[model samples]
Target: MNIHQLDINHLKSLETPFYHYDMELLANTLDAAKKAADKRGFHLHYALKANFNDRILELIQSKGYGADCVSGNEVQKSIDMGFPASQITFAGVGKSDKEIILALEQQIFAFNVESIQELLIIDELAGKLGVKANISLRINPNVDAHTHHYITTGLDENKFGVPNSELEKAASVLRSCEHVNLLGLHFHVGSQITDMNVFKSLCVKVNEWKNWFEERGTTIKVLNVGGGLGVDYQQPDENPMPDFEAYFDVFDKFLERNPNQEVHFELGRALVAQSGTLVSQVLYTKSGIKKNFLILDAGMTELMRPALYQAYHKIEKLGSSNQEELLNYDVVGPICESSDCFGKEVTLPISERGDLIAIRTAGAYGEVMASRYNLRDEIRYVYG
Candidate 1:
């Protein structure tokens, strides 16, 4: 809104549905994140799983940030995109033998080891490679992120990091492994965490764990509190950037880190989610018996968060003039599945066929999660 970022006229001339990325907004967001991280001397690794577009990757690389990869392909993409192996951190619940071998060959910075079995596999593979595998045991703090259950990962019930009960035992096992060197402890409460108290709780747990490891004479070098800062999905135009300075300040104030130890974060949504929008066309306005329906060309295949987590995204009518009357309608999509609906009882200006509709706050997970369901074409990108 500040810059009249997207051109409504230009959007109408283009194809029906496509993802539009605000390159300027992305630059600003990255600058803010880096500046905030610099204030506390924190290291950031852009999570590649968020958005792996080459252009996006290139911009991130140019900012002198690293990559946080969740899979083998993501790791390789980071490398191929020229992100130094020293700066890349790989993390996932289930890593295959081949994937571990691939990462071992790449000499990745550290593996956020989730399970004891994964620790052993990495050690064996690293032995075969004749290289020491750097790893940080991902410990579950059991601190509730207070976010959606699907996105929350640090709870005891989640199938992610090692639980608190078996952590000391896992640390002992990690210490005995010859080929795998324990860098430190890793933690990720969840994604879209807005409460700073959760992070403060995580810090308290981290301090306790650090003291526990130190008692066993283990010198922890890195403290990786994985990123979970949330963005405003309901109002991207009003607040294009989240308070990264405040976010970093929370960790700086609470996390009790050793003087020489490094602090790192793996941020995805907070970095790129506010920089893009999904633009679609109003295919038809159906006069239904119960209520009106605004059928859109874009659906769950193009942006699946609403269907996956029942997420909220701000919708706007780009081509509507101020004189147009506003009305309430269910914004449904062309997909056959009933779950493909974007929003229910949405109020927008009077819209008809060919009216351009813009779905805001889609940069992080929108284009990346697109599917070819119903034989519909996948999302195409247009950078602004």
Candidate 2:
């Protein structure tokens, strides 16, 4: 029910149901992240799966951040947008042969292999190309992220990384492969993680895993503690960016590393979520059987988080003065599905037809997940 104040006069002139990005806010977020990571000597690999907009990718690359890709095209996109192959890392659970071959052809920095078979496949493919492929073992630390179940990835139940029981097999394959170099270990617990203790638990597991590999006579070069730090979605304006300093401090305090080891983080949501908002116009305010429904042209097709995750995004009634009395209403989109509702019993100022509505904290999973369901027209993007 809390919404950030906006430039209503300027917003009214733009078309409705479009994603509005605050470039200034984005620049500030990037600067804060860079300063925090630099001070602690931690390398950042901006996760391209979060938002793959060409402008966003180029902007992040310009800031000297590395690329974290999950697919073959993403690998090429990062390189095409100016990210060097040495600074790019590819990760996924089910990578195809084509994707693996493409990554080998590009000579990417490292591949986060999830299984021993994946390691063998990469070894075979690299041997065919007569090139040594760099790889990092994606070990599942089995640490609970303490976040949503749908976003959790590091648990033993998840279909993500290799388990502890398979370490010997992984080591055997690594020793057998002649064209693969086991550079280090990688672990990603989950997304939208707010608790720092989850990372502390992960540090303990990573230390143990690193020691396991080192004891086997393998050098652990890179400790890739993947990123899942959550942002303040309920109060986006109050906390425009997540506390990156505190996040890095956790690793600095708990994670034990060798003198020659390097640290890396793959962040996505915390860097871009607050700088973008979904803008839509109210179409009608009608009384339903028991509650009032405020319908808008934008639906799940444009912003699917509310429908998919039952997520809450702060809603603001633009052009309405603060002095106006507030009322509770169910904000619904034009989609025919019953789950197309954004929020129920949302308190907003008295809204009328053509009133602009700002859906805050939609920068991460909002526009990227837009769909063509119901054959809806594609949305547009606006920059502030």
Candidate 3:
């Protein structure tokens, strides 16, 4: 269910400027995604970078999904949340010595090694620990995700995976690292991706690279096509859940792999975006000769996507008034910066002081990216 279906009186009484998570929707989303992946013998790993709320992780773990972590603490959090170490895959461009050591000690599934240098470091750390580290080469496939430039990750210029030009060098380095065991390949183009053709193109790149390694007598066991599925930010109610069937169908139809190979996905946003909403109370309303404004207690400090990436989120005024006139209002936050605006010319009903507002489709990056920039109260969450 969308935020509009929530009990207005209940939300209004507790607080303003807090996250409201619909746990039922989250469960339904997870069930749908898992069913689709399991039907195709594909493994799913929840990317903890999306929303690492304790309860969210607990519910996700209860579904028997793996953990895709990018930080040392995330790895530990997954462990603490009861995600098996063997189901955890640690991936990032720069892995500090401490992080690498932690992952090694935990014996995570594999490290999606980005560069030849990182491979060497993992090997050194693993050697000191007297253990072999399983690693998957994170390859830069150069496929454009057709997303925001800041989020695009697979291009040759991106600071992520090892580019094609360096594969030969990486292979040579891999052969020398006695403590590092090569398992497979990993590719992540970008996030908030909406196009299906992008996945088809990625399959072509994965095929080319997979064959390139097998030709050299390398036995590839895992093919991790990292997730970039986008949710409907414009129309959350219309498309509450991403089409898991269609998404998995793209890979199952196009990707070529050995019978023994295992496919993995690192999904974050698609599974949780629709289940979250940012609720706030309108503090005041202002009218200028040119524009109207609805000042809210919530700011970029509460939901930073609109300012950080120019992201779009549908805004809804709670407690519908059948006779209230619809008017354009620029929704803004109390943050000091001028960029703290949430939406410009946002159309809403006649609003007033203490009017409730719901910022839809904020479940993914909203609360997780919040800051205490203005010494704002620690973000709170309400689940139903």
Cα-based TM-score, every candidate = 0.98, 0.97, 0.99
Model 3: residues >4 Å from true position, as ranges? Answer: none
Q: Indicate the residue-level lDDT of 139 in model 2.
A: 98
Q: Which parts of model 2 have CA positions greater than 4 angstroms off?
A: 1-7
Q: Rate the local accuracy (lDDT) of all candidates.
A: 0.90, 0.90, 0.94
lDDT digits (tens) for residues 188-230 of candidate 2: 9999988999999999999999998888789999999999999
Model 3 lDDT tens row, 1-384: 456777788778977788989999999999999999999999999999999999899999999899999999999999999999999999999889999999999999999999999999999999999999999999999999999998999999899999899999999899899999999999999999999999999999999999999999889999999999999999888898999999999999999979989999999999999999999999999999999999999999999999998889999998877788999999999999999999999989989999999999998988889898978899988887
**What order do you get sorting by lDDT, best first?**
3, 1, 2
Assess candidate 1 and give its TM-score to the true structure.
Answer: 0.98
Give per-residue CA lDDT, model 1, range 1-384, as digits (tens): 321455677767788689888888898899999999987899999999889989999999999899999999999999999999999999999999998999999999999999998999999989988999999999988889999999999999999998888887797888789999999889999998878888889898889888888988899999999999999988787888899988998889988888889999999999999988888899999977788889999999999999898899988888567888888888989999989888988899988988888888998888889999999886788888
In model 2, the clashing pairs are none
TM-score ranking from best to worst? 3, 1, 2
Between candidates 1 and 3, the one scoring higher on lDDT is: 3
Residue pairs in clash, model 1: none
